[model samples]
Target: MPNNRSAAEISECIRCGTCCKKGGPSLHHEDTVLIEKGLILSKYLFTIREGEMSYDNVTGQLIPASSDIIKIKGRKGSLTCVFFNEPESACTIYDKRPLECRILECWDTREIERVYAKTRLTRKHLVSTIAGLWDLIDDHQARCSYEKINRLLKMLGGDNKDDALKEILEMIQYDTQIREMTVQKGGLDPDIVDFLFGRPIKETIGMYGFKLKKQGDAYRLITIPTGQNL
Candidate 1:
């Protein structure tokens, strides 16, 4: 609701911390100093995969469109920014906060959007510090690319239909196992793992017009009626 106003009116802030309570700010290139100074740890941040649906802050809509956002970790089991001290209603690292935080004005969002459109911190930027982690992510993505899965699904219905379906299901199970082993060995955080690998194998399969049902340790595919949208 901020509009053209005097400097004093623009400076007015209630310090309610409502904005911080909603979610953590995305880090930008300008905020790298905070990480370099050790005020913010890489482990305390996570990435949102490209193509994933997320809020469009500039438009103020919950649209399924967003870039690979790197944001500070929120409190365990809540969306509140980790730096937010609930009782105190203040940011713990206010001075060294991310660029988005430093530029935000509750009364006006123009400054924030201008900064957001420039540069943002991404997984690639952190690759040098965590090369092995990035390698693992690349390996996993190569193995489970959606295009590969879609091709496998399309190969169905020619001959030996049942056998082909069984093979696809087994491949999915194998992919899941590989992800589990990688995460276990890498000791990467679970949130990071989920973001990198995306939804479970069964849910992903569903996106291709097939429903996966879990039976004990195995899986079964249930095809939807023909002509139904995938």
Candidate 2:
């Protein structure tokens, strides 16, 4: 859930460790710096293979970060992750974790995919070129369909688009699983109200959109239901 907390309000959370098992989904390049600075570990005690392109075991489809996502089936003992501290049921490194870790949650009300794309690739390529597919989506919720996100990223710029798509698909699944989605009551974002959704803020109060109004006497924002007339 993109961390609704303001920095001042954000505190280190207690270890719940539900996320330690997968290490994390695809991470940005800057994420490595955080880990290097003692923010988090490699997730794997060590990567058996770094960004090896292959397929998902369950889907039986080749994936780029095959090394991290699934173990080479039958090659080694059932390749469970090294960092999954099952005993503690918590992350070994929480204080210096990355944005991915900060956003991950065990569950959220939103229905999202279970797996997401991953790769040893740095984060730069993911955001600028891959996430740039904002032009293709039909919604203004700042979302890309799981299939669309992969297709667009593959068609756009990337060293390995096929691998990029595979990795990206993993990230998409992972992001949603972690509640890394932007949620709105009725597809409302003031900018998009002006742009995409095209629903007016005040004129059509009952329109198919969210209901919002000024908070206190200040510019703070809050949302209300369409029925409450807030």
lDDT of 1 by residue, 1-230 (tens): 32346545755556677788878988888877787788987666766555434456787764432445678878887889989988887889988888888878878878888887568776666564666777866675566655566566776867766777876777677667766776687665655554455545665554456887789986788887776624
Q: TM-score each candidate.
A: 0.67, 0.29
Q: What value does the lDDT take at residue 181 in candidate 2?
A: 33
The window of 10 residues in a row where model 1 has the poorest summed lDDT is 1-10
Q: List model 2 lDDT by residue over 140-210, tens digit each.
A: 22342224443444453666656654444444343333221322433323232211211122322222222
Which residue runs of candidate 1 sit more than 4 Å off their true CA positions?
1-11, 64-66, 143-179, 187-213, 219-230
Residue 86 of model 1 has an lDDT of 82
Whose TM-score is greatest here?
1
In candidate 1, the residue pairs with backbone N, CA or C atoms under 3 Å apart (3 or more residues apart, or in different chains) clash, namely none
Query: In each prediction, how many residue pairs overlap at the backbone (N, C-alpha, C within less than 3 A)?
Result: 0, 19
Best by lDDT: 1
RMSD of 2: 21.1
RMSD of each: 6.1, 21.1
Q: How many pairs of residues in model 2 come into backbone collision?
A: 19
Report lDDT per candidate: 0.69, 0.36
Candidate 2 ranges with C-alpha deviation above 4 Å: 1-18, 22-24, 38-52, 55-61, 64-81, 109-120, 123-230
